[model samples]
Every structure is written in structure tokens, then in C-alpha cells.
Target chain A: MFELILTLVLLVIGFVFGQIAEKRHFRSIIQREAETRDLLCFNERRIPQDMFSPHVTLVCGSVVVSVDFFKHFVATLRNLVGGRVSAYESLLERARREAVLRMKAQALAQGATSVWNVRVETSSIHQGQRQGIGAVEVMAYGTALVPR
Target chain B: MGAYENRTVPEGINVSPVHPLKDFAVLLFGVSLSVIAFVIVLALLAGYLVRYVPFSYEQSLVSRAVAPWLEPSTDPLDQQRQRYLQSLADRLSSVMNLPDGMQVTVHYVQKDTVNAMATLGGHVVVFQGLLDVMPNENALAMVLAHEMAHVRYRHPIVATGRGFAVTLALSALAGIGDGVMERWVGQMGILPMLSFSRSQETEADALALESLQQSYGHVEGAAALFEYAAAETPVLSLPTLLATHPDHEDRIRRIQVFAQEHPPAMAPQLQPLPDYMKSKAKSNESQ
Candidate 1:
């Protein structure tokens, strides 16, 4: 019974560490997303007339978080050590979907019908810099146009 | 008596002499296990490091290291060509509604390929072969308009951004595994990025068409230029340009449809070239 209790305590401690790591990772991703969106906002204002399409300019934006965040988080767990790398694949997948969805929502709010020329850019911004907050920012933007 | 009691053994057994060899063996075993574990942890950390480091930072470092090895070009003919192209770009910009403080410069290349492109910071380059094939001012304008669209849309800057993003994303993924797996992620991600570039091209084309319509009276000239290009170059076909622009035939069809559905408010009034310009063209053609 004593051994059982000791094992339970160890497991709880490991779980707590995993949660803390995961939270840090999540915060970084969100902060990066905000920085990228800010950059895109700046770009929107600076577009010249030559860049503007008379028919319609559709701007779609997206962000992708690094998979390493989840990978590192899982690896840090003592019990999860030696397991297949695929153990945390689903978490990364979920993050990617969430990031893309948030971007789509922003694009929709901007009154874009369809986004063309879709391209994604990524940057690493140091935390506490005036320009951005996060380890890296991934941004996707393209002309949003109404179909003729 | 106290010292003797401390050294006493409870059982009646012989006290053996200390063995340096046995002590060394146990110590070696413990050290070996520790070394192995340390190596395993370091290996994992190294894998993560490789993934997280930005590729651009490495590229810049290498380029700086090799800067002395690169040769600088000093051809007078190239300089003259560049000046002529720059003058032409100035003329083109004077007729368009350009944003204040934005400067457009043009360069002419001696290459035989029929291609023209624009880079960020308003630098445009046209190939000599492309000039030879355009046949008329309107055709040249069409090409210029397209290149301008690329600049106005800031495609180059956006493209560089996308490239940087993908590299970082993949590098971060690389941290998740061994070298072999990281390489696989990099290779697999390339196709999606290429597709994304193709979409950007289409967007640029649409914008170019609209710009042409607004700047010129009729969208017909733009359409005619595409037709001429399609006839002159087999590579301009939709499949070939799909990476940058949609199929030429598709583009032409869309322009025609667009023209028919929504005619411009006023027909484009094309200005005749000056006598001096016409004479220059005639002389150049004879030469």
C-alpha cells in the first residue's frame, strides 16, 4: 500500500510538470499569433493603389504554430519517455487546425469572399520586444477576391 | 577499547584485504551507466536544437563568410542598358497613379529568354528577347502592367515571408525527431508551399488585369497581349504558367467574359507614338 501511494505521488508530480510545460507552450503560440496578426494589419494599411484590385481584393490570413512545442512538452514527461513520437501528434494537429480557424475568422470579418495568392510567412520574435511577443510568428496572407 | 569495538565484526569470519581492482570495477560500471544516460539526453537536446534554429540565420552567416569570394560585375554595356530601362520606367510611372515616395527603376538584361520580372523596392527587369518579341507598344505595356502588379501587391516581400515561415516551422518540427525524420518533414512540406505560390500568382494576375483596365480604357488590349503571347510562346499556355498564372487560354477566356459582362465606363484612347519614337523604332527594326 505504501509503494502504491508513492507511485501515485510520483505520477501526479509528473502530470503537474507536463501541464506547466503545456501552458507555457500555449502562451507562446497565442502571443506569436497576435504579433503576426499585427504585422498583417500594418501591411493592409500600406497597400498602394497599384496593389489594389478594382474587381475585389480578398485578403485571407492564417497562422501555424510549431509542432515542436507539443513535442517538447510530451518528451519532458518522465513516464512518456521512450514512447513513440506519434504520442503527441494529435495535439500538434489540433493546434494547427485551431490556428487556421482563427485566421479564417479574421478573413471573414474583413469581408473577403475568397482568398487567392495564399502564402504563409513565419518569423521568430523575441519575447518582450516592442514589435512582437513569442518565440515565432507564422502568418499567411493572400488577396481575397469575389468570384466574377 | 572504544576504537576496537567500532572495528569488530559480529560473526566469526576472516577479514579480507581491500581489493583496488574490485573497487575500480564497480566505479567503472556506475560511471559507464551515467555516461550513457548523459549521452542520450544530449543527443535528444541536439536534435531539438537543429529543428528550432532558423535557417535564414545560418544562410546569412554563410553568405557573410563567403562575401569575399563573389565577383562584382563591371560591364559598361549592362550599365547603358540599365539606364535606358530606367528612363522608360520613369516614363511609364509618370502616366500612372503611383503612391508618393515610391520609386520605380528598371533594368535591361542581355539574356535571350522572353521574360520580365519585378522585385520588391520597385526594381523591374526586362529581358532583351522579350522586347524583341513584343512587336508593339501595347504589348510591351501589357507586360509592364503585369510586372507592376507584382510589385504593387508586394509579392516578393510576401513570398520571402512565406519561405521564412515554412523553414522555421519545419525546423521546429525537426526538433521533434532524429535527422532522418526532420529531412522527411522538410521534403514533404515543399509541395504544399509550391501550391500556395501558384495561388498567389493567380491573385497577382487578377489584380494586374484590373489595374490594366483602370489605367487603360479597354481591357481588350490586355486580352490581345495574352493572345499574342500565347501564339508566340508555347510555354505561356495555362499548364506551364499555372505555377504563376492560370492557363493562358483560361485567362483569355475570363478577360473576354469580363469585358462582355462589364464594359469599361469609357473606351481606352490610345495615344499615337511621337514621330521621334516611331523613327527610333523603325531604325531599330532595320538594324
Candidate 2:
């Protein structure tokens, strides 16, 4: 009985805080993604030789996000019938976009006009395997080209 | 266009975030409810499927499956006492209402744990500690008959199958429910798991009492051992969920009441524990 109450309480807390946090995060991610959209980010590895710039360097950004108890609980339910865990899908999607935005910010900071060979790597960072993903770390990296 | 050519690309565009919390929450609730219904259907199907397995095959399957974990007992005392217990089992089996083709094989485990269990394949694992504690053959008879009742009804195999199905269901539940159900599933794969339903326990108890009534023509001291055990039952015990047996105290009272209603045809005379078994118990205890 106490456990049920505690679970409900945690769910409620997650619902309130998680909903607020995710909305805030998605907003930030959207705004940042749009801002970074024009930055020449690509997965292509051929670095355009010397045409771009001699100031070629690596720019990377990473973001780690955790799912609140409510979302995790939902994802676990989804696992039973074996469907897409859309909750975690959104989680990873948010993480990846945030990572990209940060990487673009780093490129802009370096005065680089464009970036190429963009790579986004994601991995599980915590032991929420049985449940849903506890937390995820996403890192976005690319080679920045400056017109130096 | 000239300004854009010279300026850093679109200074990080910002769009207002959409409101999705309400929709997400509602969708999650809907999905979870359906998932719950789906799980119930799966459990019912698994439960239904397990009942039709042929007795011989179930016995063979369960025996082979649990064989590796038995860790065969080598103690000399175990061998002697097992023979003692088996003969008693044979006597009771002769008179008890048993299922067709169900032959109880009593396996002696050398452990001192004061408990006995009926597992899959009509396997009754009796520990040495239980033998030492029995005041008389009557009490021991009660134990064997009780386990035999479990066998006649195929309780252990049904439980094992239930455990298997439930564990898979719980795995599917995964992150949805609280951690408690997961812990419950963790206990499933092992033998001698889960407390039998109260109905099953009562059924076994009644059957044992009937067997005692028939075998001795009088049931006496059969429940006395449980009275003693009830006194020793710990204040802190497994949660009802984890308890493999009914509370000895409550069960003792029930057994006494049950033994009285159907009076035995004659005064019961219980055989005392044999000296060889007593000596073996002492030696094993010393070790």
C-alpha cells in the first residue's frame, strides 16, 4: 500500500516536473536547432581539401538527459507488448538535437563558417535496462572549416 | 543577401515549444491500461495450456529440469532416513487418494533446513532437519501425506509453469509497474517457490487429515508437531507473498480442528523415531 502511494507520488512528481522540464527542453532544442540549421553540418568525411580553410579543427558538444519516473513507467508498459518505446524515442531524439545544437554553437564560437563529417554518438549511461532508459549521453562532433 | 553572405548563418533560430505534456500523459495512460488487459489474456492462455500436459511427461520433464540443482545428497544418514521416509510414504500412498500414475519419489537433501517441499515430477525433497524434529512417525506421516496431496494435485508443476509464465509477463511489464512485481518474478524460476494459494494449502491439509484418519483409524499427535513448530515460528517472517507455507500457528489450529471433526475409528498409536535415525541425526548435527 505504501509502495503504491510512493509510486503514485513519484509519478505525479514526474508528471509535473518532467512535463515542465521536457517542454522547456523541447522549446530550447527547437529554437536552437532552427538557429543552427543553416550551419553546414554534414556526415561527409572528404574534408573539401584546402578550399575551405587551413584552420580545420574539431568541434564537439554533448548532452546528458534523464527520463523522469513517469515517462520511464510509461516506456516500461510499452515493453510488455513489444512496441516502440516512444517515450525513450523522444528522449534520445531530444538528446541528439541538443547535442547538435551545442556542436553548432561551438563551431560558431570558433568563427568557423561550416562543419563537415558530423557524427552523433549516443549510449546508455545508467542501469535502467529493465525499466526504460535511465539516462543517455549524446555527443555530436564535426570538423569545423574557417575561411582563414 | 550581401549581409547574409558575410554573417554567421541564421543566428540560432528559436521557435515556440508546443504543448505536448497533456497528450503524452493521456496516451501513456491509455496504452498502459490496454497493456494490462493484454497481460491478463496472456497469463490466462499460459495457465490453460499448462494443465493439459500429460502426467508422465510432466514428471519426466520436471525431474530432468531440476536434476542439476538437486546436488545429490551423499550423507550416510540421509540415505538411511530417506529409506525410512520412503517406506512411510509407500504406506500412506497405498491408502491415500492419489492421482493416476503419480508415484512420489522422496529425495533426501542433507541440509539442516527444517522444511520439506513437493516439486515438479512428484519429487518430495525431505531435509535431514525435518526428520530430527519429528516426535513420531505420525507427525512425519502428516508431512508426507501433505506433500503427497500436493503431488496428487500436481501443485508444484502448476506453480512452476505459473512462475514461468508470470516471469515472462513481468519481463514484458519491465519498466511499467513498480519494482515489487519484478522482485516477485525473480523468485519464480527456482523450485519450492511461492506460497501455495490458501485454497491449495487447505486442500492439502484436509487431504492429509483424511489420510491420517484412514491409515491409523485415529488421528492423534499428527498436528501436535505443528503446534510445537508454531510456538517456534519467528515473529518476523517472509511476507505473505514469499511464504511457501501457511502460517504454522493458524495452520496448527486448523489441523487440530480438522482432526477432531472426523474422529478416528480407533485410538491412534504412533511409532517413535527409530534409534538408528536418532543416532544419525545426532551425528549429522555434530558435523
Candidate 3:
């Protein structure tokens, strides 16, 4: 009975904490996305030589994200019915946005008009022996172009 | 599609569009992982609960699943032997009061193992080795009744359900401990092979006895198989607790006590086992 109660408490904590954290992250992500709107980012490999100036270098941003207990519990249940895990979807979306935002900030600092040839990579890192939470690392890299 | 390729920018607008393979890959990986997990967990749960629900479906499902593995032997001798076994089962089941299930159809699988099992959809599988050892009609009836009780109470269904639940729970708990998942997975592998609860076994035994007395007017060789095992050292070495069914001696004692309380109308006389079966047993013993 005590164990059940403890589990319930942990679950409640996970839910509350997860909600607050996710909300904060989404708000920040949106703000940064708006700020970085002017900075052009392209996945195209070919550089627009006419638009491209001489000053070019590498810019990258990396971020790590881990899910809360609530999402973990939901994922476990979802593992039973099997469909889209929106809880996890948002987790990745946040991490990806954060990584891109950091990259955009770096490009702006470099005085580049836009970013091109963008790439994103993600790797999962699970930690905690008995009660470990798994985390994902998302890294965004791109070439910044400063037009003359 | 619109790459610069050393040309002038058309709109001089937004940067390149996303061609996110890695993102999709992760999504696919997560979804596939969840789907696999869901299938295993749901199957386990459904397999457990399906017994309580009555249907003719389980029988056909199991038969179809096992069809490819079995050699389709339509030999006359085999058919005759199977018919005999089925007729005996039909006779035994006619006397043994059952719930709403079909007349038990006993299948004679030509395996040299001393075992019998009752499964979903009123199917009783009798091994050739079991027929070889039975000493008399009464002994055979006793085995039949025992298996019938399992069908009556849906013991197989309950057992499978429990096995599935145990496997799922153990795997879930594995996340909390070091080196626990491996052990849990190993245990899941063995849980299905376990026997029903001791109480379920006891119920089946008691019901079998009731059935034996009703059908034959006495529980004569009800304890014959266990007695044989006791008289001779068994090949396998398993403790009573580990055995799914109760120890034959203990079961015999229970039968005797029940018999004393409710004596049969006719005193049972020992009948000799059939010569063919006896010979088979003898051949197996020598081998």
C-alpha cells in the first residue's frame, strides 16, 4: 500500500513538474523562433554565389532534453495501444527548436545575412540506474552567409 | 527544389526548407518500438483473459496454429486407435457433469511421453505413452475425468492469463533494478511452462474423483498412475511444490478420505491393463 502511495506521489510530481517545464520551454522556443525568422536557413547544399559574400564559417547549436515521469508513464501506456506519442513528439520538437535557435543566435553574432546547408542530428542518452530518466541530444549545424 | 547553383536568388527570401531525415528516423524508431511493445503486452493480457470468455474460436485457432507442425497421418490403424480414445472420452464425459462446453474430442497424438492435457474449446490431447501405462478402463477413466475437470473449470485459460500477467509485471519491474531485466525475461520464458495454481490442481483432483465415482461406481484405479510413480522411482526429479499437479501420494490420501465419507455403491475390483498397452509399456521400459 505504501509503495502504491509512493508511486502515486511520484506520478503526481512528474505530471506537475513536466507541465511547468514543457510550458516554459515552448514559450521560449516560440520567442526565439520569432527572433530568428529574419535569418534565412536552408537545407540546400549549393551556395547562392551571387548572394553569398566572402565571410563564411561554421555555426552550430546543441541541446539536451529529457522527459518527465508523467510522459514516461504515458509512453508506457502508449506502448500498449500504439499510436502517436504526442508527449514525446513535443519533447523532440522542443529540443530541435532550441538547437536551431542557438544556431540562429550564433549566426546573428557572426553578422551573417542567412544560414544555409543546415543539418540536425539527435542521439538518446538514458541515465539513472533504478529511476533513471532518458535524455536526447539534438545538434544543429549550418553555414552562415554574410552578403557583401 | 530551388537551389542557388551559382545563380541569382529568385525572391531573396527565406532560407532553405527542411529535409529532416534524422528527425523522421527518430520518430519512426520511437513509433516502431512502441508498437512492438504494445503488441507483446496486449497479446499477453488477451491470452490470459480469453479463457473466461466462452467460444468455439480458441479450439480452431490452436488447431490451425499447430496444423503445419503435425504430420497428417491418415493411416487406418492410427484412425482406429484415435476413435477408440475418442469413444472412451465421450463415454466418460457423458457421465461427468460439465458446464456449457461441447462433448470433449480426445486426440491421440503418437508421442512416447506419459502426459495428457485439457485445453481451450473442449479439446483433450492424450499421449500414446499415457495409454500404454493405464492399467484398466477405470484408470483410463480417472485420467479422462481429471482432464475433464480442467476443462470444466477453464484451468488452461486461467493459467495462460496468469503466465502472461506475471511475465508483463516482471518485465515492467525490471526497469527499476540492475541486472533484473535479464532474469525477468528468463522467468517470462519459463512462466508459461508452469502448472496451474495448487488450488486449481486440488479442485481438478476433487472434481475428477467425483466424476470417477459417478461414472464407474467406484474410484478404483484413480490413484493407479501416482501409485505406479511412487512404487517406482520416477525419471524426472522435481519437488512436489514445483510439480503443477499434487503429489500422487497426497492425492491418493485425499481420495481415500473422500471415499470413506462417501462410499461408492459397488466395491471396485482391480482390472488388468490391456495386453497391447502393457506390451508397449514393457517395450518402453526395456528401451
Please give the CA lDDT of all the candidate structures. Answer: 0.51, 0.72, 0.69
Worst 10 residues of 3 chain A by lDDT: A73-82
Candidate 2 reaches a DockQ of 0.15
Give lDDT tens digits, candidate 1, residues B1-287.
Answer: 11111122232122122232343244334433543344334433444444443434433553466333332226554555456556655655665556555566566666667788876555667876676665455556667766766665555555655566556555664544443334434444554555556666666666666655655655655565567667876553334422445566777887778677668787656543233232244355568
- Report the backbone clash tally of model 3: 3
Please write out the lDDT profile of model 3 over residues B1-287, one tens digit for every residue: 35333222332123223222333345435644543455456555665666656545656765687545444348554566677777777777777766654557677777878888887666788887788778787887778788888887777776666666656765774554334223424433443334346667789889888877777777877887777777775666577645666677788898788778877676667656455443364465568
Write down the DockQ of candidate 3: 0.06
Better of 1 and 2 by lDDT: 2
Q: Which clashing pairs does model 3 show?
A: A41-B16, A42-B16, B48-B161
lDDT of 2 by residue, B126-232 (tens): 87777778788888889889999988877776666766776675577445555633532333322123333555787888888888878887678778657767778
Candidate 2 stretches with Cα past 4 Å from truth are A1-66, A74-148, B1-48, B59-80, B169-198, B265-268, B279-287
The candidate maximizing lDDT is: 2
Q: Alpha carbon lDDT of residue B121, candidate 2?
A: 81
* Candidate order (lDDT): 2, 3, 1
lDDT of 3 at B82: 70
Candidate 3 segments whose C-alpha is farther than 4 A from its true place: A1-148, B1-51, B67-72, B180-196, B232-239, B270-287
What TM-score, computed on C-alpha atoms, does each candidate reach?
0.41, 0.59, 0.50
Interface RMSD of each: 28.6, 6.9, 11.3
What's the lDDT for residue B15 in model 1? Answer: 18
Error of 1 at A132 (Å): 41
